[model samples]
Every structure is written in structure tokens, then in C-alpha cells.
Target: MVSIVQTGVANRASVIAAFERCGVEATRAATAGDIEAAPFLVLPGVGSFGAGMEALRAAGLVDALRVRIEAGGPTLAICLGMQLLCASSEESPGVEGLGVIDAMVEALSQPARPRFGWNRVVPEFGCEVITEGFAYYANSFGVCERPAGWACAMSALEAPFVGAMRRGAVVACQFHPELSGPWGLKLLQRWMAMGVAAC
Candidate 1:
């Protein structure tokens, strides 16, 4: 399964190795194919919300992903990529997201700006449906969702930002699942086993 996405700031080798441990043949984001044929897609990011969306638009991946996932396909978004799944992001003043999930990506409510480094995504507030642990985080914005099964994993530092969420065919994670080692792979495999229709 190829990890289809935009830009390459995310370590592909690490992602490949992670997916391989889960019994998958991972590839880059640009393998060139449709939803049914490709099956799985991973969106990873490591930069500003506005800049990342611009890069995706420039590469014409925004619509491509929307179309794919809209048709009942499987997709995983990590870090900044998860931020782009919302309707809008505070990090980017006027930038638009895929709007797959009805939420907005807002910056953390901290004294300073640009929250970085690792945080503990403890399973509090019924956010345990997803992988729960001290996952590595490196993002500014997070999702505020309004769904029944809207699950979120959070760190100890901030206000428990949306660590991971799934709605229908879309899945997004605020943490670096690829960097979380085997635990990340296991969660990813669960998403893969869910298949396209399960979403």
C-alpha cells in the first residue's frame, strides 16, 4: 500500500518501515492511481497549516484526495495533514481545508505561540478509541469536532488536542504515528483492516 500525500517533509523510510511491520508494502505519496485500485492513502505534514495547504493545492492533491475519500476509500492524515481535514485552520488566516470533517483547526490555548516537541496523548474524555500513549507531536492547530463518535487523543501539556479522529471514510491523527514505532503500525493496520467500507 502506497502512502499517497503531498510534499515529503515526513520521513518516507520510517513510514515504509512502520507499514512493513504491519504486513504492508508501503510506497510514496505519488504512485498515481484511483481510490479502489490504490485502497490506502496516508497524508503526513511537518510545517505551517497555510503553507502546507498551498503546497497541496499547487500539486493539485486537495481535490484528488477529496474525490478519493469521498468515494468510500481509506485515508490517514498525520500531524499537519490532520489539521487540513477541517473546514478552516486558525494557523492559516484564510486558508481552506478539505472540509471532510465538520471542524476547525485552532491553535493551542497557551501563553506562547508555536507549540512544539513531544506530548503525552493520554486517553481521557473518552478519546481512547484510538491509539493512546505519549505520542510525538509537532503541530499548532487541532480539530474541534461535533460528531457522535468523534474520538481524540491528547498530550499532557496542552488541552488535549485532537490526537486522532474518524468519520465515515476519513481518518486524521495529530500525532506522528509513523514515529511512534510498532504501536503506530498496529493502529495503522487497524485502520487498514477497517477497509474502505468500514469507514
Candidate 2:
């Protein structure tokens, strides 16, 4: 089973559906306790940084997530969820992030804004969870600097950005693997298999 954090600003239905397609049972984590006890958790977001943080705070999940990630919990954070792992985002000045990663989310240098559709992700090192493939992305802001101690993958809108980063059992993706078609489904399957093996 996969417990998905209910941030209220996430693409919940699609995420759940994706997990279902993977033949994994996916449920919403309605409380912090649910998050704490989940074997495999997913933090997905599709909105502004401040709004996502506000929803997680309102749901009383901020501290729970911090503890989970700090302890190297099996987690997959996507898009805005990936940004929330940082210390802060330029998208929301004065708003603090989860601080799991010592980096900041910044606006993309490209003028096109929200670089939508598919882009290729090239892993910087040998990564078990990330591979070189075209993944779907829909964001205007991204982390430009790769955090130390994490395996990173890169993608470019105009300039390069951290497309995915993995450390221990936690994997964060700036692109939507769930929406990336067959390549993405395979990624999700691999992630789920890894979680099962960890158990």
C-alpha cells in the first residue's frame, strides 16, 4: 500500500490512478499518524509553493514529513512536492520549506514560463530510480543547483535544472513521472518494487 499525503493542492486523483495502474493500493493520509506509519509514502503537489506549504501545515503534516524524510523514509516527492523539500522557494518569499535538502527553488531562466510537455532527463551518476528518458514537466520554477550528497538528474528548459534527485529511500522528481507515459510507468514500477524489497 502507498499512502499519499493529502496536501489539498496535489493532483490526487491522477496520482492515485497511477498507483492503481501499478497494481498498488493507494490511499490518502488524512492525518499525521497515517503519514508516520505509512510503509511507502508519496508527496505530490501541483500548485504554488506557499499554498502547498499552507495546506500541509493546515493538515498538520509538516513535522511528520520532516521526521519521515530525515529518517530516510521511503518517499517519492513530485513537482511542487520536490520544491517543498528545499529550504525555500523564490516563488514564495518568506515561506519556509521542509528543509530536507539544503537548496532553494528558483524561477526558470526561460521566458516561455511553465515549460510544459516532455523533456529528456539525463542522470549525473548511476541512479537506481532515474534514467535517461523524456519525462513530462509542467512548471515555471525549479531547483538550479544540485544539493550535495544526493544523486541528481538534469533537464533543460533553456538552462539546465535538477530534474530529479535521490538519496537513500527518498526520490524527488521535478518532472511528472506519472504523466510521462510508458517510461514513467516503468519508473513507478521500479520505485514500488524497491519499496517492497525494503520491506
Q: Pick the candidate with the highest lDDT.
A: 2
> How far off is residue 32 in model 1, in Å?
6.9
Candidate 2 matches the true fold with a TM-score of 0.96
Clashes of each: 3, 0
Clashing pairs in 2: none
Write down the worst ten-residue block by lDDT for model 2: 108-117
Per-residue C-alpha lDDT of model 1 across residues 76-104, encoded as one tens digit per residue: 88887777777788777788888776788
Number of the predicted model whose TM-score against the real structure is largest = 2
Q: Give TM per candidate.
A: 0.81, 0.96
> What lDDT would each prediction earn against the true structure?
0.68, 0.89
Q: Judge candidate 2 at residue 127 and give its lDDT.
A: 62
